[model samples]
Target: MHQCAKEEKVRVIACGAIAREIIAICKANRLGHIDLQCLPAIWHAYPEKITPGVENAIAEARAEGIERIFVGYADCGTGGLLDALCAREGVQRIEGPHCYSFFAGNAAFAENDDDVTSFFLTDFLARQFAAFVIEPLGLDRHPQLKPMYFGNYRKLVYLSQLEDENLKRKAKEAADYLGLEYEYRFTGYGDLTSALTRL
Candidate 1:
């Protein structure tokens, strides 16, 4: 962020679960006058209204006299937030892809290998999900659960965390029978970056 600020002469505004980590980095580097926009985890569960969330965040950023706002994370819940915010606030948003990919692609320290990138990304996501569940939600680490096999992929079967326990149990059974491996996998940002380069 400090490097970008020096080059672009603008402030960096970040959002998502990793915002605090970015803040720590900025503070450690003595980067001042940064406008950070922190949003709720609710958007992760429900990604539909993320446009409004971005709008609200942008409004807050503008109020802070930030000349430019750059979103470092743009995936999962915060994927569309930057676009919505750009449209609403009429500020140009830079093309920073998913968090991992962006970092991996822009990494100047080393010549990244494709295999190494893939391994790191996968591990990173797993660690991230594990941390979120364990630290925030207080969830227990049970056996590695597989997604229940449900044959009717054609049918519009909704699988939400809000579903009743009975329905969830049934879905799980179906997924397991179907051999669905829906376990969260850590994907390194470098993997995404390399994939994009291939394209």
Candidate 2:
């Protein structure tokens, strides 16, 4: 996952999907104290890999003499396994059940009922729609499978970390592809800013 120089920087074991956003936030805030390490973003399709991957990253960080570590992942479909790993290792992860929740602000996202049947996309998801979703889900090869996979999903909500027209268009195209309604929400970093700044 990561290799460090046994310095004073705080290591961040994070989800690769938000790696760009993390770099953006750190740069904007001048958070030069952090050392960001991300696992493969494709793991979103294989959640069983998250906890074990994070555990290994943690062990590696510790071995590199990095005591101060921050996990930039949410629960991320690992159920409570990530939380258990955090507790057992005495480390802290970003708040919220997943990126959608945290990027929308955890408390506010919890109270929103629209998400019940909404398929979500962040900037990364929008940009990597083909590799992350269409190709991985086999929708590119078997178009008929789209309906079966997204039968219950009513809409696609794109949570934006940066307001970009290209990403918005891509997101809308994804929604159209899936035969779902399109919704765009500009949520810049949300609680992720506060979480990292506090460290």
lDDT of 2 by residue, 1-199 (tens): 4332344689999999998888888888878788999999999888899999999999999999999999999999999999999999999999999999999999989999879999999999999999999998998999899888999999999999998999999999999989999999999999999998898
- Which tens-of-lDDT digit does each residue in 1-199 have in candidate 1? 2231333233444445445445555555545544455565435445665566666666766676666665444554455655766666666543444444344343431343422212121222232444432233333433333222123232212212222445444444433433443322222233323322221
TM-score of each: 0.46, 0.95
Q: Candidate 2 at residue 169, lDDT?
A: 98
In candidate 1 the C-alpha lDDT for residue 151 amounts to 32
Alpha-carbon runs more than 4 Å astray in model 2: 1-7
TM-score of 1: 0.46
Candidate 1 — number of clashing residue pairs?
A: 18
